[model samples]
Target: MKARFTPALFAHAEAVLGQLLRFDHPADAVVSRYFREHRQLGHADRAFVAETVFAVLRRGRSIEARCAGQLSDRRRLLATLALVRGWSQRELAPVLKASEEEWLAAAKAMPEAELPPAVRCDLPEWLYARLEQQFGADETLALARAMNQSAPLDLRVNTLKADRETVLAKLAADDITAAPGALSPLAVRLRDKPALAKHPLFLDGAFEVQDEGSQLLGFLLEPKRGEMVVDFCAGAGGKTLLLGALMRNTGRLYAFDVSDKRLVNLKPRLARSGLSNVHPGRIEHERDQKIKRLAGKADRVLVDAPCSGLGTLRRNPDLKWRQNETSVTELTVKQASILEAAATLVRPGGRLVYATCSLLSAENDAIVGAFLDKHPEFTLLPASAVLARQGIACDGDVLRLLPHKHNTDGFFAAALERKA
Candidate 1:
């Protein structure tokens, strides 16, 4: 069905609301599957259903609070349209019962300050408390609000084949209205999200979809043309492609991950990337013996360690509900172990860049601190200095890219060099 800004579209959103609330998989994946199964939905219809479902996911706690705590999936979807999208009762009357309209009006009129802090911020209590400690009360709320909003699409121009100006011009000629990214020199920020899957530039390996913060990690790694490099935890090889391009496709870049499923997805991207230096392989874990020979051999190693994915809330809002402190605690242990194992691959005087898409200190700064404490041969390289060499300027000894601060997904990276 080609849905409009009509009640029928809202009905479709309501139908899938419960599936998202169950949190069996990511909301985006669930929504994609729903559209795939229901092939009758038009692009606008899918967009309407997706946007409404995401809005509810972002503010479920607050929406439920407004609905007197017993709201069903249908009511949650309706409340999202009314409160978040600002749809008027008259516009919604096409699908609502007479009594339902009255209830929605009451929900919309509820006082904001009456709700608890966590509810007002639409965050769970544990998450709110943790963020409050680091960001303080005022800034935590500010960060939460930023995360609740939609993420803008960011693409990194393949410098080996095309430059940023050239790509920006092409996008402009196509009426895409893109501009140079403020942070990463390789990045281009689009004014509006468009499907670039079939664009000529994408098909020809001119650029790849990467967050501006993620592009920063490649810069921090700073792989040279002939140096050996490893992208540990290279899920789908997003960063591996950037690293290969930076090496001008002259270096041996190994992309290792635990899942063959993820490694398989990387094959197409590696082919489209127009780079011949990358080797994608599946590993048992960070300690797999396949990496033993590479120890003390690689010129640079990037441990883009697995994390809670909390920094990507703008794109993956359901992660907030799916994760808790227990999961984060377990991840910290794995992250530390992986970092220690990947550090072994760095040759003397070679660089090791550890990064995470997490907002928490335990997964980022603390882990780095513990590693530095245990390993006397490695010394910290200032992230600001490394970024400055690449024509990007950001403050901090470590690269801490927060959504509120950088307008990119939250990321933390520390560059370490093994003493020669």
Candidate 2:
């Protein structure tokens, strides 16, 4: 049944939350499929379902703690709607019984400061400890608060097709309240989240739905026209298309990945992007002979390596429970291997950019540090200097964009050059 405003909506939210709680699949994917199967649900109803489910995810740990061990997917969902949504006793009277209402009152009345650190922060203890080792308690708490909220919708103007000023004026003319991004010249942050999938500008490929922080990584790579570049882990070619456009479609921009399925999705994006220089190719691994042919020849290489993805908690709150120290430890090893292989393709004096959406030191600095230790031929370049040269102002030898600090999804990027 389609989700309606009555008790069915509550039941529907619990059903979707049940699937997402298992952590078998991504929350967004499950939610998308649920809506697809029941297309009768309107836009407002969908938003209510999605927002409520995501709120439960964002505040799950604290809610569980508040429930005093009396919790189910349903109670957790209801309590989140009550405590976080500030639904009153009378407001919840429709769906909740008197006992449940009394329990909710107790949960809301509990003093949060008395709760354990993990519960108070709504983070796994292991994850909290890992972050606290670097960020300390106060800073980690601040970052957690920022990550717990919803992320802003940011769009990157495809400069090859549309300028920022023109896109901003057009959005204003359309009554979409938007302003230029603080960090990236190509960014336009929407004041409100509005669906643009069917908009004329989107149809014409005027912009790509990219995070403002993500747009900085392309600038860090800064591939020039006619230069050879590679997006080593080009999943769906998000950055690959941007790099091709940056080159003005003049260079051979190779998008390499192990999954042909993801590379296949790049086809439509490439067409919509109107770029002909990008080659979407699948390789067995970084050691594939096809990649060897470009060894020591490409002008720039980007290793947007996979990681624990904890930095994107605002978008994927389930990641906190899905990832652990063991998983992250294993990922660090894989990241090191990928970085080493990607580095081999950077010619003498060519640039190599190692980046991740992870904020962990083990995934970011440790991986880059190990690579620098093993490969003595590469020298670290000040990422800030590179951005400044391109007229993008950001400070840091290693670019660290944080949700609390930058209001952008957490991202880390390092620039290194092969010694001539």
Cα lDDT of model 1 by residue, 162-269, tens digit? 999999999999999999999998999999877799999999889999999999999999999988999999998889999999999997999999999999999888
**Native-to-model Cα distance after best TM-score fit, residue 135 in candidate 1, in Å:** 1.1
Task: Specify the poorest-scoring 10-residue window by lDDT in model 1.
Answer: 1-10
How does each model score on lDDT?
A: 0.90, 0.90
User: Which portions of model 1 miss their true places by more than 4 Å?
Assistant: 1-3
TM agreement with the true structure for every prediction: 0.97, 0.97
Q: Write the per-residue lDDT of candidate 2 for residues 107-219, one digit (tens) a residue.
A: 99888788888788899999999899999999999999999998999999887789999999999999999999999989999987777888888878889899999999999
TM-score of predicted model 1?
0.97
**Model number with the top lDDT:** 1
Cα error, candidate 1, residue 297 (Å): 0.5
